[model samples]
Target: MKMRIVPIGDQATLGDHRHYPGARLLLVCSLCGWDKAYRAERVIDRLRELKSGGHATRLEQVARRVAWNCPGCGRVKWRCHFAWPPGFDDREAKRLANLYRN
Candidate 1:
């Protein structure tokens, strides 16, 4: 399923995806087929820096200029997505058992 990542405000106001437990920030580089999932909280930290002293909270704007330093294939540009589906990963399994439950 396609996930939606909506960044609504600054780190202090919007907080991190950690509040969602299993949520992760997925970075995919079409150029090299690089697909990696990083803790959303940590990814937000880096994104805060990439904000480049701007007050804008639009993630797409900030991410447009961000680049990932791919150790396997040197520096590469990547697109970001948020994922918090059920069965995300071992690290988040226990906490996200009720991910989609009503």
Candidate 2:
């Protein structure tokens, strides 16, 4: 995989992603407090996904903003995610792996 440099939350970093081709994305939703992690290459990819497949209308508005209210929870804490360095401690790594299993 090519190491792509994308700007995220005012910080730029190299990451592995193909969906978003130019800039990195960090979404902090105010709806569900899910704090989703996304590596977006451009604003358009996020917008397009929300407009088409993701079914998240809330995400579309928060695309370039640092913080916004989430649609799910009616609170910002539950719905937003920001640019954070992805270093998985052992426990976190294990927890994430569990998501892939049945």
List TM-scores for all candidates, in order: 0.46, 0.28
Give candidate 2's error at residue 50 in angstroms.
Answer: 8.9
Which residue ranges in model 2 land beyond 4 Å of their true spot?
Answer: 1-24, 30-33, 46-82, 88-102
- 1-102 per-residue lDDT for model 1 (tens digits): 444344434342213343455656666664675666766556556657766533223434434656557665676666655555543565664546556342
State, as a TM-score between 0 and 1, how close model 1 is to the true structure: 0.46
lDDT values for all models: 0.52, 0.41
What lDDT score goes with residue 27 in model 1?
64
Error of 1 at 81 (Å): 0.3
Candidate 1: give the clashing pairs.
none
